[model samples]
Target: MSNVLRIALVDPNDSTREMLKAMLLGMDTVWLEADCSRYEFFSDIIEQTAPDVGVVTLDSDEDRAIALVERLSKEAKDTVILAASESTDGHLILRTIRSGAREFLTLPVTKDDLAAALGRVSQQKFGTADGGGRSCEVIAIAGATGGVGTTSASVNLGCILASDSRNSVALLDLDLALGDADVFLDAIPDYTLADVVQNISRLDIQLLKQSLTKHSSGLYLLPRPVELHDTASITDESLRKVIGLLKASFSHLIIDLSKTYSPVDMAAIEAASRVILMTQLDLPCLRNVVRLMMSFEEIEGLQSKVEIVVNRAGLESGQISLKKAKETLGREVYALLPNDYRTMVEVRNNGVPLITQAPKAAITQAMRDLAAKLQGKSGGKVEAEPDKSAESKWKKFWPGAAKS
Candidate 1:
């Protein structure tokens, strides 16, 4: 409870422990009072040292670590319990929090993450908010196929969200090979996802935030790597680790995903609170939407989180009707993005956001409504579905489709 806070830690891996120690040495307000390798012996060290904070690394043995946390929460009431792990899966974080950990840190232990955790303990024990981060809402935008305006929706929605002075939004261009989110905003970033993954050991919230390209609308952009080879090492776990850190700092994370539905996209989808499936009222897009929905049905709880959005709804005379599109998707379209070829093409070529270039355009209003829907506000009404008995080529095309 003094100016310098006392700390004790338990991590079995010598390398990871040393890395953590080096990180802690750089933090000026913290003092390493004692350290232990064994989970059972950690309690005794805390009892003897009387440290203000106790750090427990859970990757070595999760069961024992949770048990130790529960025990310390009751026995050593004065010390704040903090948990760490290489995995950011919700199950571990939830269980650790339930066992009475004050803050959960992801491993290799970013310095800012540690400082924020300890700062939270300081605030709770004495009233301060030095490094605490407000919680963030993550939204994943996926395309049914190419040219469906997935990136366009993502960038515009992000810009609209950032228009509010009270909000801070970050856009992640996960389209590794063909991403244009950076070009969309006309902001070139110094670093990309690959740089973050390669330098993960040295990354902290402060450093990572500084590396991103901040747009004039106050939106932070993390674009895809410049070279295709740079994306090879960006795996699901690494992407999750980066996302976990970003979630700690931003208010909103808009992930513009690659259309491949690879492991990387699955990881982002798994982490998102809202998933927008961008589709147009065309035969190919609709079929792909249903196919994707079938895949989602297999993934336990994924289907419920998705919202089917129809882009370029009134683009052409031959396109499918909104009523029939609903019957084809077997679900109501979340929102309709009107087709404004001149406005959109100009905005894209000029590298300006629709929200900025064409503020009064109908598509811009559609972006606002999309943001409102994500925020649980009243959105534009969806058209009601027509009769299932109506002879439909889509129903006949794909057997065992959803009931109309």
Candidate 2:
């Protein structure tokens, strides 16, 4: 009697499967349990053979391969799936990982590489892996309308969060077609969110990091697609999966959303720990904020997580005052960002975050304060007391407004 590892092989090529079986038979520590030409019977093979490991060949049929891996991972919980492919394309490797493969190997496999891969599987099975599970806080930022400084705020906030050495931050430009987050950081990423979504089935922490463009401030950005047509390929399910993976891998996840509330936008909102609703000190922006708040209130527990951010506060003389704005919206102002037009323009032109270029600027300090409040480092205070008299006025404007 000899100690052996039970293995199951699934390959469409007859000759390749036979060769692999012969190689495994030659190894005293390995036991060939089953061999097949297709993955459709993988469940039956797993039940009959009780394989400790399942090696499946991935060829031109990528969708079928991915589905097989996913099903095996879910159905045969005790068995680990190792995907093998002739092509060493990065996208293919990523898709394999996303499809729930425990490991990926290139074809014409060597015994040493095979042994190393199996070693890891054994370690994971015995619970000796370090930092096996971790979670991250996800924050979603949305503007009431265009030019409300939503992208600017998100970039600065992400930079500030990443400033902490212990924290890892990722900023996702969910606007898809019209995102400018990369421009704010002055980064021209080779890979965008479209690349990630297209290969979403293979997405893992390593693949995600590869797709992101890193900034000098240590923030990672997943930019929007360069072409508008690519946006159509991004589905709500894919967005959720990408966001879910980001949440698991980073310390902070920031999403900059377009003004329109598409299904994908709603999915991001649902995943967010807090939704920063950005607005300006203007009548139209204020009215839109009220309407958004009413909609959020309809969703269970969403209203409580919303924090109102008044961007470009005190910019113009005729703009709505923060005091009156709060009364009109029937909620406390979460934070006030100062208006610094010249500095903003310079920062935008330079494609650098305000925190990095002008660290001591008032606007930068305001951004820092907001970050601290979000991280629970400071208790965010309302600058002015709510006017009880204005409560009636808000009700008159919108009878459904919640009384403060």
Candidate 3:
């Protein structure tokens, strides 16, 4: 087990606090063993736990939340400050931001929202040492458009790289408002990223470990909070601080960026060491890729770092050709993956990597090849050409018999 990402929560309501604690406890990597509610009690939790992120719900008096944010950010220079509100008031939200709150989520938090926020917090921590000293490598994965298998790729790749005997990897889901890494992994976490934002003043490795979901294969996941409203609870600065912490603890950090760009996503992209841009043959997907490529080029240090990948590259179903795609984008494709339905479906159902279950399958082999490519490993004997047509085998094995 690697170092944990410490977090704190400060919701006035006892039930809310307890619920948040329980949710955080579900993450095998996060240790929510401490609770600091009272002002006096908080000092002790800070001294004992030394959390890396702090989450605090908005109080009746907005000043308290603002004060908490300022104090936490100063006390824990690297700590991430997350502020939560029951109502969405523009004024209060702005005030929270002005006060140094890094993240903002509306009331009634969900699992996905929490995961994404924490994932950002964790990834930001990566690439930098404790107290923000050392520089490290950070990887960001973004799909050309929705459903381009970016999330699946990011998760599986993180698992593969982290599984390496010599390296430690952390997979962060940065689709802050609507990420689903937990569902994919079949994990129902007790704590969402909400807990971390509520207590930014005192964050430490032990507290951080208590917030992450660890797999049997040693993959650490920071899922997104399920509820959209919970996104308002976090701020951009808070997100960056958390990512810094992640860089500090892990050797490799993989971030899955949602199709849509937001302040949070842009921040992750800016901090990334490499950006894996995923696209398919469809025009819509290709167009988006072009736009993102153009946009990334404008950002400092991104033009030369973007890597393009053409997924489902075979000429069977998709309309666009590799030559046309290259001509249109003016960039060579990094890697190609054939459309293998059976293995992909199994992966969707089991939430495990295809290589782990069906290593010999074409899709599995492609993923292994992709992993090697990402690791910059070349000269290995590539697997034989895959039977892309074998996907039809599953059609005949459908659970329900179709009427002729």
Candidate 4:
């Protein structure tokens, strides 16, 4: 176990302060050193408790929050200040970040997010001497278009990764309005990502784990909100914070993204250690892949991290060949998943992974192979036959593209 982080809570509202107090008490890794509802005696309380972390709620009064953060930075230089608010507005976040707040958290704070923030704070204050050299790998999965198996690949890959006893995995459904990662796992979670974000001020790892729906295979899921209207509440800052928290808590963070390329989606893709661009072997999908790749190339250093995953690899005779896909995308195919319609349908209906339903199936083996490759256990790479003609045709998509 890592060293326990000591924290003090300061909030104006009685209900909000108590909620934060209760959340702190529930977490084993964090100790509530002091909790108060007034800013007047916050310095005295900090001096008394000597907490490692200070959590100041800014939802009621941003001025007070800013003052408290600035005061703590000046007086108790050793203590790290974390500002909490309900607002995801860029201006407010910028203000808090500028005012010496080590991290800005949206209210209804989850345990994972808070813990992750503390871990970063701890590392900054005490270096790796206390964090035990902890780190997390974030993998984001995106589809070229719909029905390309992005969610399925994310869920199963998470499951496979979690199957290893040493690895702790979390599958985050970032699709927001239309996310169905829970449906694939046959889980009806009590809490969704919206619930966590709305109450981010009070979130802790213990509370977060309670909100997550844990599968039998040890994969924890943070599903998308049920109400479509709730999706509007999810802001890019909050999404980034949530992803940060997930990365802090889980060893392997697998994100299932939607088709749309919103700011939040871009943030996820940008933060990912590897972005699995899932696509089918079809003309439309291939064309879309080329376009998306071009977009990614515009963002510095993202193109090299993208792994092209060709799902339903051998589905039909007339579809785009592997050679053509490599030629069109100008990247090596990372992995190929077989077309197992019956197994996929059965697993989807039953809400289980192919590994559990049909472990002997070729699709299952393909997923395992993918997992192994991702884990760097296998050196095998899919080599495509040279197709200079296809390459030239695809290059026409980017008119002014300079050769790297």
Candidate 5:
């Protein structure tokens, strides 16, 4: 029950078994059911456990592995056979296929690739997003530009979502070097994101529950690595694996991403069910929005999920008008948050959420409305009406999202 995948594996070479074990352990969904070095014992183990998936490393002994795969395919018809080898030879892959292996992995298996391959098995079996029974919503919050209140939106929105007693929410600060999500909640953590990835082999739902810092609002937090040096170990693959695991466990996964257009950010964005692009009414922020939209256009299916929200609206009379901003961007603005600098400053300093600290403030109400909208509820005051075409129509996109 702790993990979705109950995996039985066989590796003829004992030298590579430990490496394979570490990679599989790091995956959030994988549970090592039984690992054996002898091919003769693998089928017996698979029959006894009837694991969800069976993995066979072929490089150590291709003929033996293929024979095992063929035997297991018949003997354990319920379990799917997954083959991996350091060799990328087409003939070898064909042999695995002919022998009844359902999937093949080019070896030197990365944690990400390993996780993804196993995930496919789970998906093929369950017909859900992952092996985990639940399909949680992943919300990635990005700034139109730095200092435009993206992080603030992420923090408050997460708190609002977690306020519902039925919802299990996890807030991830993915800014790496300068993330302050933990500070925003006023919780000091004994563990950080780096700790999870570094010790991935031991990661499970129970262990994850123990590692995350829980707030009074019932929101769980996994802040960015405390030391800047720890950020280096957080690869794009590791991040995706962590995010996938969180998605399985929580009802809502809120990610606060950095302004850097790094692979790490893109990985999170790709995993998200919705991307909240936070902007202010300013020339600089608008310009960045244009750039980001154009960039989003290049990626498949990325532009459609983006929901543009104007943060700190009405901060200055001189700022851009919502109408003009929509005309400039080619998409309707989704929501607008009022300017409440003093309230926000107080909330952040006290390490409390806006809803809890300044519940009656206008901005707090706006935040609640925004949360309601995201939660599939009505009563959101700020919207450009229901426009289904807004997401896909790129013609005349603000300054045109086309980079050419």
Candidate 6:
């Protein structure tokens, strides 16, 4: 048996279908199942190969696409089917999902959308990025409370990976208007995320990549719009499509989600392979994290994927210890990043990652440790010790998660 996640591509256009297959195969770790267009051929290969995921082109005719989804669902209940079409109607997209498509996209197929869809499929099958074999990791950075340094963590982490000379990382600022990722990177993109979201139906990997600004470190950044109101109403559906595209193109995909929760942010959260909830050691931050932890625990398949990160951990002491915070929130603080004033200002002034500015700083070292963990390194000294008493508290707080 092949050791890769088998993906079946179904599109009639020879170029489009082959291009999709080739792009996926370029990953060198994915197994391409039989490519077919005709309904009969598709059914045959699907039964014979038993692909992990399905990619079917949505016909101009809704009835035809709906019928295809229905038939595929009956044949492979466990398999996820992703649909693609040439239109970007909200009603049509919703209708397809309701009909049984796990995901939807518009063509000429941007690499970003394709990647996001594949990432979703990978997550659904394997649970986490680390659980899967040879797939990109989707890490989302969000704040438990506003201004907890989620954006900075994401930006610096992305920069570190991009500059490591080992992997390709793409940084996405999903904050829409208030996003400072571009400003921090000192990049003023001529094209904002508005171009991709508004023109998603016509998106392709080439155009999507072209829309981004490449840093000297080889990091690709997708910045939000300069005017927040322009994209405040952006839908989760649109965000998923774009993120999916990025996943297909980059090995390490980092998302800087908006501080406040919205449809766009929720979509990113759901699609995240792992969510880093940033917080500080303060009463309000702890309280908010406790509440947010409850919500994460309540949501299916979200609890185990969330990683609590305490930024500027040593900045304030005694307001709350890591033990008390974990006890209150019912989760472990996966990483503790210190505050270094000089490094902070340097990053702010230069619009680059702290690792690039002061790689030896206390804060940068903490980030490097976190990144190493993400890359599956082990035996490194942990900065914070696990609180034993907090274990019972967490179990009581989230019985289901504890039981699982």
Point to the candidate with the largest TM-score: 4
**Comparing candidate 3 with candidate 6, which one achieves the higher lDDT?**
6
**Candidate 3 CA-lDDT value:** 0.70
User: Which structure is stronger by lDDT: 1 or 3?
Assistant: 1
Per-residue lDDT of 362 in model 5: 98
lDDT of 1 by residue, 1-404 (tens): 12445688899878888888888757755656667788989988888777778989999999999999999999999999989999999999999999999889988777877888888787776566552233467899999999999988988999988888767889999999989999888887899989998987666555777878999988899999999999998999999878876775577999999989999999999999788999988888888987887688778788878888889878777798988777666667878899888888888888899878989999899889889878767744455553446435445556665364
Q: List runs of model 3 lying over 4 Å from the truth.
A: 1-135, 379-404
Worst 10 residues of 4 by lDDT: 126-135
TM-score of 1: 0.67
Q: After superposition, how far is residue 142 of candidate 4 from its true place, in Å?
A: 0.3
RMSD of each: 11.5, 13.3, 15.8, 11.3, 8.9, 13.1
lDDT of 4 by residue, 1-404 (tens): 12356688889988878877887766645656568888878889888767778989998788877877888888998788888888899998988888888889887888777667877876775475344444567889999999999999999999999999888899989998788889899998999989988986666555666778899889999999999999888888888767755664677889999899899899999989899999988988887887887788689999878888989888867687787667666667888899988899999999999889999999999999999998788975555543455655666655554352
Give the alpha carbon lDDT tens digit for every residue of 5-38 in model 2: 4588898888777777777656534546678887
Best by lDDT: 5
| Alpha-carbon lDDT, every model | 0.83, 0.82, 0.70, 0.82, 0.84, 0.76
- The alpha-carbon lDDT assigned to residue 99 of candidate 5 equals 94
Error of 1 at 355 (Å): 2.1
What lDDT is reached at residue 140 by model 6? Answer: 91
lDDT of 3 by residue, 278-373 (tens): 888888887777667656656777866787777777758657888776666665677787787666778778877665767687766777777787
Minimum summed lDDT over a 10-residue window in model 5 is located at 392-401
Please provide TM-scores, in order, for all candidate models, with all chains considered together: 0.67, 0.66, 0.61, 0.68, 0.68, 0.65
Model 2 lDDT, full chain set? 0.82
lDDT of 4 at 35: 81
lDDT computed for candidate 1: 0.83
Off by over 4 Å in 5: 1-134, 379-403
- Candidate 6's error at 148, in angstroms? 1.2
